[model samples]
Target: MTSIEETAPGRDHFTDFDLDSPEFTEDYEQVLGDLVAKCPVAHSKVAGGYYVVSRYDDVRQCAQDWETFSSEGGFEPGRGGEGGAKLYPVELDPPYQTRWRNALGPYFSPRAIRSREANIREQVNYLIDGFIEKGRVDFVEEFAAHLPGRVFFGSFLGVPFSELPPIQKATDDAMRGPMEGRGEAWVAVATFLDGYLRARQEEPPRDDFIDVILAGVEDHDGNPCSWDHKLYVLTDLLAGGIGTTTYLLAGIAHHLATHPEDRAALAEDRSLWSGAIEEFIRYYASIVALGRTATRPTEVAGQSIAEGDFLMLSFAAACRDPKYFENPHEIDIRRKIAVNPAFSFGPHRCIGSHIARLEATISLEEILRRLPDLALAEGGEPVYSNSTIARNMDSLVVTFTPGEREGRTE
Candidate 1:
């Protein structure tokens, strides 16, 4: 695998695109736009090679037709087994995947997520209180990055908040660390999850999500899932809940800080925040691309994909397809999005999307209310890191008028 710093450039994107390349990280929107128009299904030789599906329609078709483009092989290109433990459901095909979704979906439904909004809002305000008085802060590190884990642990997963730091660090390293170190990072994450799950099993059942996971579901053949498989599911939830939401939050914060006019509009009209949140999710999709393997021979946008070939379905690119979204580059809060691919599509569509939206909406509302004068500080440009699975913002600094804390919570 090529490192981002060592990634060579000047290759034809249509024939040899690399998602991990610095080119993709720097010119993400442009590279995908060209591909969507010129070569909807472009090939890449990175990580033993794979094809990229850039257009909205093609990416959706591939994601929806999981049988033709199987995920059981894992979602990373080239590294395949080397990418660390397989995340359940996202890496599973139907029947078994469906079973898991059926068993767990209710916990993440809009209604269920809404019930936790108070908890989410409390955490959002609490985090802001920590930095509201500082007058300056790294938005990503100080706020966007921490809220999701706090909510996930406190409201959904029932884990101790103290356990979040190490798990969060290990998760970050596994996803964005050096190539050789990622696997070890994943092992550390897995070890933590393993113990957490076992400890939950030993305690009296709380009838919560964790206990539901411990109950275990049937495999395709009706066999009970392994303890390790349960850990995979839990790990996937933690990563999806925390890591992806962090990017969305950071992106929204950066946009608000840079475009005060837009922020003002949203601040004046709280109802617009919902649409703006959706627009932000579409514009700054957290997972840039995810891999799907050809279960057999298939064709996408006139490109012939051989059996067992890996394809990177660029959801970030799909969201920007001109055919699907008019004025694809601009953020239109009122633009009616018939279908947003930001959370992906088909059977494997993200189950935590409601959580993400609610979290974003609350965070945006609080930030604008508390940090209304928020603006980018001098030399404060967002730092980003790209990978086959996701794109993340590492830092975003902002300055705001100092505000008083609302007093500590019990």
Candidate 2:
């Protein structure tokens, strides 16, 4: 295995563009477009020793071929070691990874998620009720950010609303990348889940997700998945599901507020919900990139990459690549859409994709119904997250007409 230092001589890739820069976040589409056009497989010295794959075909292939590009180590540079362990099945390769994934798959299936719809809708309405009367609210914190964490935890673990705050805090910290005191936060969350899992194991089964995972039997590397493994998997699910969905929700709200015509068109026909969500995902590409390590020395698109070299597959760039979709830069809800790498492609595709769609679709439909004339607050600018793994807005303020019914009493 090539060390991080020896992988590239003399420089790091991705120095010119600051992944966290406000300018990049503001003009992300334009910047990525230029890069794809100029150098689809560009190498940057600033990003340590990694190469960026921006074209649609390249990214799709990188995601599909687990043999050539392994996900075992952390996808991004410097994250593969200890930091990557928290990702669970996502950070593991096939065969071994498949066991854990298959074990948890039934819990997030379409039918299972549908069973929770009434509860989800009630929760959404509750959150919206708290803010709808105000006419103006920060959609991220007051609404979007709160919904997913609560719903996922409530439905999966059968936890009470009181536990959401600390869970949300830990998940948010994890999404922001490694931080001081995060170890303690992870421990606290893990400890709580361990107790919960042990309790569930002893009791008669409930229909919730925790019951499903615990009741099912699976072996990882000759050993049964202990409570620790279950806790880690839950942590990964909470972090991955909540943060990305929140970002996409904020993105949709931001776009709709600015482009009333699109919102109006959708309002006229609620059947367009599915397509509208797809268009939103393609337009925003919230989770910017997926990380991979070259399992063996591989040559892609005429560029030679050595074994163990870090690679960043730019999903944001690929989704908008004109090679795949015409007028890729423009957002058109009417466009005939197909499978997008937005939820990723191949084996490691998002397990919670169905749930995410249900959440986003329900949230959008309800928001439009309650406040049809929503618009961004005057001079409001979105605050975005900085991590390379996930792209998200921190906050979005909006103004809309009040609903007849109040949402949450608190």
Give the per-residue lDDT digits (tens) of candidate 2, residues 94-145.
Answer: 8767877787788788887898888888888888888777899899888777
Candidate 1 TM-score over all chains jointly:
0.93
Full-model lDDT, candidate 1: 0.84
Evaluate model 2: give its lDDT: 0.76
Q: Which model scores highest in lDDT?
A: 1
State the weakest 10-residue window (summed lDDT) of model 1. 1-10
lDDT of 1 by residue, 226-272 (tens): 87778888888987777689999999999999998999899889878
Clashes found in each candidate (C-alpha, N, C closer than 3 A):
0, 11
